[model samples]
Target: MAAKTNPGRFFEDYATGQVIHHAVPRTVKMGERALYHMLYPARHALYSSDQFAQACGLPFSPLDDMVAFHVVFGKTVPDVSLNAVANLGYAEGRWITPVWPGDTLRSVSEVIGTKQNSNGKTGVVWVRTRGLNQHDEVVLEYVRWVMVRKRDAGAEVAATVVPELAQVVPTKDLVIPKGLDFTNYDFTLAGEPHRWGDYEIGETIDHVDGVTVEEAEHMLATRLWQNTSKVHFDTSARPDGSRLIYGGHVISLARALSFNGLANAQMVVGLNAGAHANPCLAGDTVRAWSEVLDKAETAAPGVGAIRLRLVATKGGAPFALRDESGKYLPEVLLDLDYWALMPI
Candidate 1:
């Protein structure tokens, strides 16, 4: 008799240019939005109120951008990172289309590059993943690399292939949702007086809020997205016996905290890069801050794009990201570069 359960794909299983269609298409409903807000302190007006969104030219409130990202990303975990040591980094991420409630989403990944690690016990795999709605329109896409364990340490694999990725998603390439007009955007209702022009390049904002991670919440968040990563769920997966908090958990927490000072930066449109600097565990109080990287004007009426560096730290002085040597500090949990839509 043969084993029926899947052992998951190992390092040697991937090949450059290989296409993998992930399983389980999820139908996102208003319940997901409610649960997401329940899990994190999400307060972006456009996602929180239908009237607010309609006033900005959208039909109604769409799901939060991170909600679409996590659902899509979770669908790929079983195939891409079930045996992964760590999710290395992300680049060239973009939210191509808005995900409304009741939209069914699915994911597909293409292996763009692979490199065998020096230790032979593990290797790195780079893949480009896309999330599509039931209409078959792509809603989100990104490039991410993960270090995965080898099934057989002695097996020889192909030569290393690394794909060249964009350091920044060019502003011109950003897709503003059709009919999104911020001309009538209300600053009072949005909960901030700042507009796009109010922010200057190189400005840093300390969002003074913190959330102590709970084991039950983190586990629930991971399961909500259907992510089956062992490290996030099973303590035995890590030698330290601590269940690792999903990096996306930190990303959402930090984004939610940013609302204190960035309440007007509405929609997340682009993800240039991200790094999970250190593992976050239960009992760690997470804090966040953001730095204005750049600003650009869009063709949309009263619309603008702002590039920001959002950083999450467990416990550290605000604005302190790296050491003199350029390595991430021990307290840093996540460093994310992204672009958002704001009224000009």
Candidate 2:
């Protein structure tokens, strides 16, 4: 008799254009938000206070954007990256709508491209995944590629066909949550007075705070999202005997640290691109900084979009991203480019 068990998909199992509907939709609530804040220093006013969100024109506070992302991404791990070597990168991501407490979130992914590595041991799979609300509304969507291991190391894969992806989501494509009017925005309460017009391209702001990653905190956050990546939970998976911190955790950490300078950079509307430049492990002190890339005016009244380059480092000098040869320094943990909304 065949033993009844489940072994997740391997690299050769994927075909370009294949659609995968992930299982187990999650109904997010304030408890997840509370735990997220407890894990990271996430204190954006719009996500923290109903009164503040209402003043900015939302009926009530919404779940933190990163929290929603984690829930959606978590659902796809089993089906997509269960045997992955690495989560490579993200691109062309946008937050379509706000996710509130009690919103049931689900994820669907389509394999857009595949390319086998020369080593014959691994291949890259690119999936465009979306998080949908209960009503079938797309709350968020993005393209991410993962390096996956092959069950048969010498297995042949389809010819390399990497899909063409955008480097930056155009500003016009940035979605504003319904009824979100920042015209009457209260800068006093939002924690910073910098509006969209205040920032200049090439300006850099060093977020002068750091958080030491703790083992328990990362474990709790990873488990909360139901993420079962071995590198994040099993120290035995790596040679150094340290569980690698989830990349999304570092994203939230850097975003939270940006509050010191970008407190009013309210809602994250678009994720243009991101990279986990290096692995983060517990005991590393993470710090952040941001550079103004560009700005654009949106049709929404009193709302504008600002493009930013956010960098996270573990004990590296601020504004230092690359070494002499332009390779990312070992101390650089993340490099993210995104669009955020702010009052005009």
Candidate 3:
């Protein structure tokens, strides 16, 4: 009899136009918010205090945006990247709705493109994934590509199909959560005095705090999100005897650390593009910096959108992202472009 155990899909298993419904829906709650704060240096007041969230016109404190992202992302690991060599990049992401406490989330992914690497041992798969709440509403969506090993080195896939993706999530498409009014936002309690108008395009801010990633913490975070990828858990997955740190961990760290200067950039509404520039390992001290990219006026009461280039690095000089060749520097761990809501 064939083994009943599930062996995750290999590179050749994916096909363009295929839709996959990931298993295991998760019901997020206050405990997720608590554990998220404990895992990272998250201090955004809108996500930290129900009273503060209510004052800003939300019903109550919603789960941190990354919290919703991680939970939704975790459900897709087994089906998408359990056998992946590396997650390449993200594009065209947007948070369509706020995931409130008690919201049950699930994920659906459609294989949009695929290409066989010249190496013959691996291939790239591009998928557009959407995270939906219990009410069948899409809360988040993004496009990500990953490198996966071929089950058979001699296997041949269909004609290569590469997708043309947007370089950024257009400002007009950025979604502002319902009833989000930041006119009455309190700067003092929010922990920073900087507002939307205070930031100028082309300006950069170096968030001067660093957090060293611990082996235990990364593992805990991986389990918390139920990311069952072998590369992050099994040291033997790679030739070197080291476990890879999850890229989302670095993203949250960078976003949390940005609080030093971007405290009032409270809610993340859109993700333009992102790349895991390097593989992060344990014991690496992660630091962050942000450059103001663009800004737009939103229709929400006293609300505006600010676009920023948030970079996470390991001991790299501030504002240094790529070398002259346009390749990410070795010290650069992440390069993320996203839009956030702030009080004008």
Model 2 ranges off by over 4 Å: none
In angstroms, give how far residue 60 of model 3 lies from its true place.
0.6
TM per model? 0.99, 0.98, 0.99
The lDDT values for all models are 0.97, 0.93, 0.94
Estimate, for each residue in 1-344, the C-alpha lDDT of model 2 and write its tens digit: 99687578899999998999999999999998999898888888999999999987889999999988999999999999988989999999999989999999999999999999988999999999999999999999999999998999877777787999999999878899988889888888888888899999999999999999988889998899999888888889888897799999899999999999999898998999999999999999999999999999988889989999999999878999999999999999999999999899
- Winner on lDDT between 1 and 2 is 1
Tens-place lDDT digits, model 1, residues 97-186: 999999999999999999999999999999999999999999999999999999999998867999999999999999999999999999
The lowest-lDDT stretch of 10 consecutive residues in candidate 3 is: 151-160
- Using TM-score as the measure, name the better of candidate 2 and candidate 3: 3
Best by lDDT: 1
RMSD of every candidate to native, in Å, equals: 0.6, 0.9, 0.7
lDDT of 1: 0.97
